[model samples]
Target: MTSKITLFQHGTGAMIVPGLFDGTIDIQELLTHGDTGIGSGDGLDGESIINNGTPLLIRGDGSVTIADDHFTVPFVNAHFAAYSTINNIQINDFQSLGNYIFKHHQYQNILFSVKLHGQFEWVKTRSVFKQSKPYPSLVATAKSEKRFESQHLSGTVIAYYYPDAFSKFAVGGFHAHFISDDQSIGGHLMNFSGFNGDLGIQKFKKLDLELPIDNADYLNHDFKNDDIEAAINQAERES
Candidate 1:
């Protein structure tokens, strides 16, 4: 994978301890080193920019607008990971299906590390937006959809906090691998996939992980249940 991705996975607190392919083995040179072009002058990842009072606004095209209050930060210094789950991913304001499957979602115990490499933002209002200072910027997205021996690309997806919004870092270029046991690269290519999450205030504890969602005990607003057999059946059906 590229530095943009490593940076994002880390910024959003994606699972996997820094250089461990799956939190079990050590991968050398943890991150894709060299001018990642992402830094806040103070040395912090995307989170730090927000922590330092940077305001980010989301546009319809998936790009971000750093509020004025935020310093002119190219990127961040400290690198850290976020801890989150699909339970938090939402869409269209209604989250029945999403809430059920992701709440306390399943977890894969493979830790990994992240490091951002070359990064450059471009301003291009001529074609898309109206264009302005620094023009609308575009990050050079990377690709890494090759499947692996353990095709199980599972783990807790980390996220971040915006003053008025709750979201994960988006660059039109975030990726992870899902290699099959036989190590075949059959995943999507240059897949423009982003975590489908929602913005909400913490209700239960700091984290509301749904280890299992039982539909039988489900309430009007709670589908907190698990049906492994049904899930398998559904997967089979879809296949």
Candidate 2:
């Protein structure tokens, strides 16, 4: 019998609203949950992409390198299933990609993962600089994010979709990160064009969410008063 596919997520987008940027889970511990995933380093240092169990860190300046196992993350989404390629699609940009997925997959109420590999005419991405003590809200941190764009780039795009109902716990809609084949450019994907690539989709049957029970900031934050949806939209979706 085949094991059920599970999406292992550590921490939630809501934590960002309270400016909880400290690491709650270690990188080594996170890797035990899944092999392929996307996340950001402690204190929002950079974007991370775990390809085939190797975690690559993409810093604010768009530099990519292997992340140390001792490193930790404030947020992550990972899974162990090997992506099953569905088709070779012509992706004009991020919007078109979403439209295609919505029209074809139609799994609006469930969590799913997407992986795209091939050449892109151009790709635009952004990463946040590492924050220090007294971290600011995600909205504030995003204001200083470094943006990078490259032409004729070859790489992999890793993304996850959370239904609107899950917005309180995750960044609803599509949250994607990219890493170049050369491991030189990567970040939170902002925009892209001329994407001729193979698309792979994985639908998950379960979502295993791990909360930071011992984190005082997370436990004491006044989440009820904040408009989390708007904050997430501004920090994550609006580019």
Candidate 3:
């Protein structure tokens, strides 16, 4: 059975969200805590894995706060939470991830901003899905706000140039939620694209990415340069 695994680990991570250009692949098989994940054996050392493609999640209600000093030195507090749905499903991968790079865009006028620090967690369960199994949340809880309209820079189409083979991409956690206190509203595209969904109830229907979400606007073009991917990978290894 394909089950969703909740990955949660509270270790001191690098402060700044490092940049992963592309082609940057690191195959480090981590030795997870023997006590965590499904089919528990030893004691719960606080970890677990359900499957390969587990549910990536990120959700919360209220300003999330934490302190960390790792990764990107001087970037302080590695925290973030971005949320969004995909294929009628919401992904929370970044929920437990620390420090995320966020970009904001303007439609009417070509403008942008950026946010660095980020944090996240996942909703334990929705009232309707009460019987649902819980997943490990790297970070949950979103800044208090009504999700009807704009959830930070969410809803707005933030595009990115993924590797050529990307049939589709997913970016969850708060980069999808809009909790970056450092976000400036315009900047560079990050390593990924936040989750896309139909939250707007206009036209009385869910806003699917396949359908038009906004007016004629700036186009987000993907630079299919293998060199870009190669550069990203080279940088990661050297760093």
Candidate 4:
């Protein structure tokens, strides 16, 4: 199959009402679209990862668990990652690794899927705790975020390189989530070092976005001119 990334709902949509959990799409429906991707569970419970064909949930305490196929998610980005190459490369740190990938990829207006599997000196990650009714906004949740760090471990980093032109609707640059080989720990990647493994690269030429028309929170909410960019940066990146 040709490489394509299907983004279900915009990142901005989640910011409008941070914990909107009444989404219609379930895990079974999601799996039909793609096998490898990342998303969040209902109530922003934890970091959801669809690796191969299994769905795993990474909690705030850095614990891994199997996700129920019937569980719902408000946002998801996935694809049947068909890579062209899985090359071995030496990477010093996170920024250098991104630079190295960019060197091979010259296009600035296209989307790309990436998977790096190997050993690392250190890796830092974060996950969202489940929220209750009358949930807080995304920015507020980011302000008091808790982070987890692992030293000298083997893992895989699943990521996407989204173009800047779609900044408002999605993650502008690289958005990544990580899981260890043991399946004991994982979350949204904040910082990491040493990419000593096979790096899979797949360039995507088409992007299909699915909006939540059945969900009222998504339909009646105001997504225009929101601080989605800032909130995403704050929640997903290191301070």
Candidate 5:
């Protein structure tokens, strides 16, 4: 029998929408769930990309650095599985990539992971500045985010696809992050002009979600009062 692929998640996007930026799950413990994934640091410090076993922190200034093992993460999606390489195709932009995946993959209701590696004609990204006590909602934080763009950059794009049914727990659609080959630039991917590379995809049959059961903020927050869908659409998508 074939083994089922599992997607391990540390926290929910819903929690972040309400500004629950503190997390008890450390990078050291998160890595054990999967060697490859994407997430953010405590207080929304930066965008995190876990390529293989290395966790990289992309700061608001578009600076990239290795994340400390002790650094805590408020939200993360990770999985351990080998990707099946799809034929190289011309990707004009981020939307095109999404269309391609939807048209070819035929797993709309399922969760999957995508990895693209090669040269990009141009790439656009953004990262949130670290927040302090009495954190602001993600939508508010995104308004003051730092945006970066580069031309002819070589790097990898790590992303996850969570169907609409999973929106309450995670981003409803494609949520992606980028990292250059030299590890100099990367963040929450806003868009890309051109992509010439290999596409690899893996579909997960099961989801292993770990919530912050002991977190007062998570337990106390009244999520029903918030427009989670609207907030996520505004804060996470290209504006």
Candidate 6:
């Protein structure tokens, strides 16, 4: 099995600074890299969830739809998932799911991509609106983010776990997105509970970074401030 994860554009920290919503890469090109992944749509319009090589969008109104062919992404992490094993597990909530993965996946230092397939008792998610020119910082956008929740849901959990060393690249801890089996609702997964699913795990041995060269805002922006990191953490965890 191949071991690699391809990242589109800059790290998450850099994105929070300039808040570049207009993506530099097209979805057609992004699909060439992997079959499963998560990202934000053009103008940060919606949550981008790629399953089976198809890009689906979860808009701010909690609406799930297919992305336009020409849509772009500023950031994304994807890979051809070749699972070592698919374990049937009973997870009561987000914390329990983490504990289970940690116990089963002993390699805490490598990158991990997971797919949880099954029924969920309840789930909560959030998605940010598209930002325009003179875009506010990610911290500001996060403050007025939209949130959605559901009960007795069935879907696939598209998630990734990155090591601490790569926290700036993406959230270091577990980050996930969900799209219901019926494709009606889902977003950046926040809290979930009562799930019985097949947990598919992929360990990546290599990482490929694709930086944005054309975006002048991203290229010349400063990402040295300490508050940026805190904002990212707060936005992801608390929003």
RMSD of each: 19.7, 1.7, 21.1, 2.2, 1.8, 2.1
Q: lDDT scores for all predictions?
A: 0.21, 0.88, 0.19, 0.75, 0.89, 0.77
| TM-score computed on alpha carbons, candidate 2 | 0.96
Write candidate 1's Cα lDDT for 74-187 as tens digits: 222212233222234423211232344345433112122221111111111100112222221121011111111222222211122121111122121112111111212212
Which residue runs of candidate 3 sit more than 4 Å off their true CA positions?
1-59, 67-164, 167-177, 180-239
TM per candidate? 0.19, 0.96, 0.18, 0.91, 0.96, 0.92
lDDT of 4: 0.75
Off by over 4 Å in 1: 1-55, 67-108, 119-220, 224-239
Deviation in Å, model 3, residue 95 alpha carbon = 24
Give per-residue CA lDDT, model 5, range 25-81, as digits (tens): 898888888888899989999999999889999988888889998999999988775
Which is the better candidate, 4 or 5, if ranked by lDDT? Answer: 5
Question: Candidate 2: which stretches are off by over 4 Å?
Answer: 1-4
For residues 21-43, write the lDDT of model 2, one tens digit per residue: 98888878888888889998899
Write down the worst ten-residue block by lDDT for model 1: 13-22
Superior by TM-score: candidate 2 or candidate 4:
2
lDDT of 6 by residue, 58-165 (tens): 987888888776888787777776766566678898888778888876868877788888999998999888888888877777777798888997998888887778
Q: Which candidate has the highest lDDT of all?
A: 5
> What C-alpha root-mean-square deviation, in Å, does candidate 3 show against the real structure?
21.1
Clashes of each: 44, 0, 51, 0, 0, 0
Off by over 4 Å in 4: 1-21
lDDT of 1 at 129: 19
Error of 1 at 17 (Å): 26
- Candidate 4 per-residue lDDT, tens place, 16-127, comes to 3454555467888888778888887777778888888788889766779888879877677788877766567778877886788778778567888788889988988888
The TM-score obtained by model 3 is 0.18
